[model samples]
Target chain A: MEFGFSEDQTLLQQTVRDFLEKECTPDAVRSLWERETGRSPELWGKLSEIGLPALMVPEVYGGLGLDERDMVLVLEETGRFALAEPIVTTAVVAAPLLGRLIDTEHSAFAASWLERIASGDALVAVAPEGQPLIADAHVAYLLLLSHGDRLYAAEPDHVQLTAQPANDQSQRLFTVNWDSQKALCLASGNEGRSLQAELLDRGAFGCAAQLLGVTDRLIEMGALYASQRKQFGVAVGSFQAVKHRLANAKVDLEYGRSIIHRSAHSVSTNSPSRSVDVSMAKSFIGEAARFAAGESLQVHGAIGYTYEQDLHIWMKRAWSLDLAFGSGAWHRARIGDALTEGGLSAPHFGFEPRGL
Target chain B: MDLTYTAEQQAFRAEARSWLEASVPKQPLASFDTPEGFEAHREWEKKLHAGGFAMVPWPTEYGGRGADLLEWLIFEEEYYRAGAPGRVNQNGIFLLGPTIMEYGTPEQKARFLPKMASSEEVWAQGWSEPNAGSDMAAIQTTAIRDGDDYVINGQKTWASRGAYAHWLFGLFRTDPESSRHKGLTFVLVPMNTPGITVRPIEKINGKKAFAEVFFDDARVPVANRLGDEGAGWSVAMATAGFERGLMLRSPARFQSTARRLVELYRATLAQGGFVDAGLRNRVTQCWIRAEAYALNTYQTVSRLLAGGKIGAEASLNKIFWSELDIEMHTVALALLESRGELLPSAPAAGDVGDWLEGYIFALAGPIYAGTNEIQRNIIAERILGLPRK
Candidate 1:
């Protein structure tokens, strides 16, 4: 019962992280934040050149044919750098959703988009579940929209987007104004509803993975700053008060990380508990990331509160992602509902398989 | 990464479950803090030893099944699921047993481990003293050498199970001139030695779960020393790692508690009681934390199997599980409301479950096994490389 990443997976994640270290530096993130569109085609191209967008696309569609487990770490690298492009929304979430459409009548449409996504020629923005805003909608060539039991695929000309600036300006969120009749229906009824559920789980899983990375960065920054920024005749890190704050945050990050990895496995295997598992991951990691951001800022004193500090990039991303896909409270409530319905058993806790 | 148990592991689990199902006491045993309860638990341990399930990961020569960490975890899950009694020799099997395997001489292993596995000699930890609680290195207990024996003097407080334990293991300053951690020695002492006294300390729950041990020129053989005289600090740290890490507090224990808490929540709802959204959320959050703890332990075990050592990062596991234990109990008590205060002996207390007793015991989780505060300091300093100053 090995519960660890494979050497190949670790190497793949490291390769992405090394690339981001050079290409998606804090300066690059800040530069994108200042842009009118808050988007960087060059950075996206470089990410695609490394096969980031094709990680989850099936090999039959000129992609890598990997799953969520393979993409979780790469998504985390995107979050560690606070990459301006919607890599998670497009590559991790939308690409896989489009790939799943191969079995439906919309196979041709999905294949064309998948091929474009694999080739780095197209960007797809998936609307956050139950949220009116869609990130990177303006930059995306295609938009995957869900309405009740119907899922639609819309091109740029079929939908209108009004830019809605977020606290994390690097994320180009927009309120999409689109008509379902103008878009092509990908799936409907039971299939559409199931796909929608899968989309939410995948999105939440991706966000949880990213939050793990963001929390790790925040703690590292806090520790580094506390060590270098001295007060009271010594490094503030020498004080138990400051040290313990970051220490507690690190504890939260460690546990939340395991939950995210477990959720990745659940999503990859299409486990029956995938929805609840994703909720658990999102809720726990979301709270952990938020705590890390706050504590890191506290440790940095007034400097962290300033706009010039790079810590804000991760802090703002934490805030944005915490509320994206599904808020912690929303996911907690979903878990509460499941617990009440299922009456709390071994299966719920992943001890024994349930309907597998 | 694969998370499924192997066919052999599954078979092991099935065997353990069946054995525990048939062998576990139909009714809960009395608290091991008392004499009769201690004897009962000792008997239970013998039964477990006879079944070769006493220490799943220990070698066959030491009364174990020679299983891996994963099977041990599976055995723990079955043990808890079957409502088995708590281990009366945890201080021996979990902490010192592993330390012995790591540092003990061949003769020491032959003399100590088999008995420890069978609870023939229940062990109590003698780490903390009145003046050296969190600062354990401040231990003043001296074991001055004379001929072939060491005369032990000074006191050790908060020694878990000391009241009825057959033996006690602790660190003592071997060099009279040495201070703090230097020149210390890890020693095992028989409780029946002359000039030794054990005065039981009552816990907040009014049970003698621990004791203060005093020694005045009590002589112990040099053979009882677990490691080199000046290297006791490192040896003790290894034991602390095991205590704070995976062995002492397995996730299945809390997972079982979480399952019970969920049952309580369900029962509360079925009683037409007022259950608020916040309380429901807390219940679900507790379950999630338990699951997360289990997953984290699996990750750690996986790393260990792949030849990684558990270091200061064990501080992370200590803080997480200790707090999680308290949180689960707190939420369960909130669900019980006033009923939570009922003692097990109280009339109409059957539905109250073990929340009150469990809660009182759990409060000590963060206190013993290195206080959570101490764990945080370790994480910050050793792990994060924060300056100690």
Candidate 2:
């Protein structure tokens, strides 16, 4: 069984990373944080030009019909730069949810939004199920809101938004007040319930991917600082105490990476174990990112504590995303329930033997 | 990114499963630490060899099926799934065998490999001495060269499986004046060689899993050297890589333990025992970590097949699996509660499982294979490019 990414996937991820290195620099992110709306239409346009938003939209809707595996690495790139944009909300969550509605009565409505999203004419924000805060709700052209088993698509005029300040300023969150009667009903009943579950898994999987990116950046920063910072006439990295901390973080990141990538594959293929796989990825990567943040700050000593150093941006993002889709403890309990219910039987341990 | 096994791979798996189902002992074999248990395991290895499943990835001439790494992984999965006996020759097949394949002369390969595969000559490692445990470069064991022979002296402690092994492979300081890592040589010696004495060392559970060997003027042929005269350190490092990496500790072993742990938790729950939420979470975490380890290994095997080299980064696998092993057993014991301390033979210990013994063995995981501390240092210095003072 092959577990490596295709060369095309590698090139796509590298292209996005190179673009971010040039356009969404730490300075650019800091500048966005200072703006009132905390949005960058220019950066979003450039990303859309590179087909980031179009990657998940159906080809029938004037967009690329690539799956989660294609977009997961790009989501990781967005996280690496801590890009102050609605890429995950628009591209990862909304586009896929809308594209899935092509078979429903809301097909025309979903297609219009998907076409706009692919061509850089529209932005979408999705409120996570049961979470009141919707990120980038103000800048989004459409909002995907949920009430029980009903999913609705509403425009800014159909909903009132109250801004909620977040620790990660790059994430502009808002509490949306919307009436389901005024918004267009996309799906309901079993269809809506299943779609909502898929949304949660996709959201959590996307966040897990981003957390991996953030953790990798944090470890890189920590190692760089340790190797450069001097203490007692030697690089601080020479000290086992400092080196081991970063090394442990690296170990956590390395193990969490495969889990995240595998989850992407699971979500893309709609594997029966998708939900548990997403939870496992989210829970493990979230904790790994948090640990990396702490070790990074500890390694940097006093400098990493200051906002001027730019390390705090990633650390704050790590903290915010760890609790976003689901917290580590929440997902752990979900897994615990699944295992206890399923009885830890053979082949349930994952990568089940095919046709055996 | 396909995770599905191929048809051929599945067929191989089916073949392995059927054979193991038919041949595996109905009753569990004893621990290989005892004499009787050691022989029992050796017999099992011979049976496996006869079945062409002893060293799946090795060439056919080496008593294997000449299978790929993926098939080897599948074989390991089925091996553990069938509750097969543990490999008494693990030190040979997993560690020294690969090193020999990499560096052995044709004669050495001919003499050692097939026997190693058949458990005809089990191997023990002699890497650590009293003063050279973590800092192996400080090895004081000397093998002074003579005509076609090396006269060995000094002691090697913590020799795994040495209590019953037929052969021992170790690093010895070859130059009297050379210090640290320099002038060292990797040598293979027969345990029956004159002046070689092995004293069994009891573990915490009073099982003789390892030994301390005192080599006083033990003569070994120079032809028995694995590599160049003064390059033993690097050669042993290669062996250490195998020890700490995927070969020795396959993920199936831990995954099997994790599966059993989940069963234990369920059995405890069915008995009307109060299982705490905290312990349940820990158990779930253990299962997830085991799965993660398995996935990570598959990714690694894929990369290796693509011609990527495994370096100090192998330390990450060592740390992950070792820690996961301990955590899995710890949660099992916690589920067992007061009964966790009871030996398998104790009254009322019925179906308490081998967690207590498993826990004892897991304690050595962090200590052996270069110690987790040394692994961390390797990750930092060699991998992260950290300075060494």
Please give each candidate's TM-score. 0.98, 0.98
Pairs that collide, model 1: none
In model 2, the runs with Cα more than 4 Å from the true position are A343-347
Query: Per-residue lDDT tens digits of candidate 1, residues B26-127?
Result: 989999999999999999999999989999999999888898888888889889989999999999999999999999999999999999999999999999
Q: At residue B160, give the lDDT of candidate 1.
A: 97
Q: For all candidates listed, what's the TM-score of chain B alone?
A: 0.99, 0.99
Fnat of candidate 2 is 0.84
TM-score of 1: 0.98
| Model 2: residue B371 alpha-carbon error in angstroms | 0.8
Off by over 4 Å in 1: A343-347, A353-356
For all the predictions, what are the DockQ values?
Answer: 0.71, 0.78
lDDT of 1 at B59: 96
Prediction 1 global C-alpha lDDT: 0.90
